[model samples]
Target: MTPRWYEEGEEPDYRFTLANERTFLAWLRTALALLAGAVALAQLVPAFSVAGVRTGLAVLLAVTGTVLAAFSYRRWAQVQRAMRHGRPLPMTWLPFVVGVVAALAGVAVVVVVLLHTR
Candidate 1:
């Protein structure tokens, strides 16, 4: 069944629709990378000095990736709707959130390594 929104708006330009699809694909790629990182971290990396820190970071990455992957489709739909309706594009904070989370993870990795080093 088609979504109500999909039925509401006229079809948007093919180019714009394709661009939105590409953007969605890019987000999925990022999500896949994050998920892969989580798996690699949990399986390949040695345990941190602090108990559960490694697991915690891995879970964080996995959750972030899951959320991003789920939301990317919503975002793509939104952009398509906006284009179809001739409305202004919607704004998003996803990039900022991803950046902050990634930065925090990087810092945590560094701190853990430093603290654990002999």
Candidate 2:
């Protein structure tokens, strides 16, 4: 089946297109923030009992953010292509994984702070 955009030779709304671009940039910015936070935590924290583990996790988060940033454009392109070609857009798993990791990280941070404060 032809895509709604191309089936009848309909042009995409420019306003919506611009909005999509803005949203993609926002995602990239969020990824950057996550990367910075991870790097700072890993590097600034002193060596302690769980320091190594926290540092390792922080590195992982930074890498994940980097990957997400790199892939953001690619994913946006895929969605655009799908819209233009009337094909299903590729599914994304990064967001779900990121969410889960963020939740776990929050729990870890709480545990660390509680222990440190006592």
Candidate 3:
């Protein structure tokens, strides 16, 4: 059996552990929101003149949500490991990647609108 994280390292304070859990939950909530938003956008928005734009945007959002959900667990584990080992928490790159995804979605929307109008 794989060794448990708590087995190898000292237990950190309860408050920090709880905080890490809360952060994980927050990311889960964000992922859910992104999924919901994508669904709503896909259904509620009228068909654009440019084919596949809405679908592409929706797919991108869904993928971003999936990535965030997956990465959040890894980040939480890393933070937990650090806390348990008395090491400084590692810097995360997810936020930057998420930002880039959001930016790309925005640009896609703009391009679709402009293309439809042209």
> Each prediction's Cα lDDT score?
0.91, 0.74, 0.88
lDDT tens readout by residue for model 1, 1-118: 7778887767888998899999999999999999999999999999889899899999999999999999998999889889988899999878887898899899998988898886
lDDT of 2 by residue, 46-86 (tens): 65455566886687789778888998887776566666555
Query: Candidate 1: where is the Cα deviation over 4 Å?
Result: none
TM-score of 1: 0.90
TM-score of 3: 0.85
Off by over 4 Å in 2: 1-10, 86-90
TM-score of each: 0.90, 0.76, 0.85
Write model 3 residue lDDT over 1-118, tens digit each, in one string. 6448867689899999999999999999988888887898799988778788888888888888988998998999999999989999999998898889889988988988788787
RMSD of each: 1.5, 4.9, 2.3
lDDT of 1: 0.91
TM-score of 2: 0.76
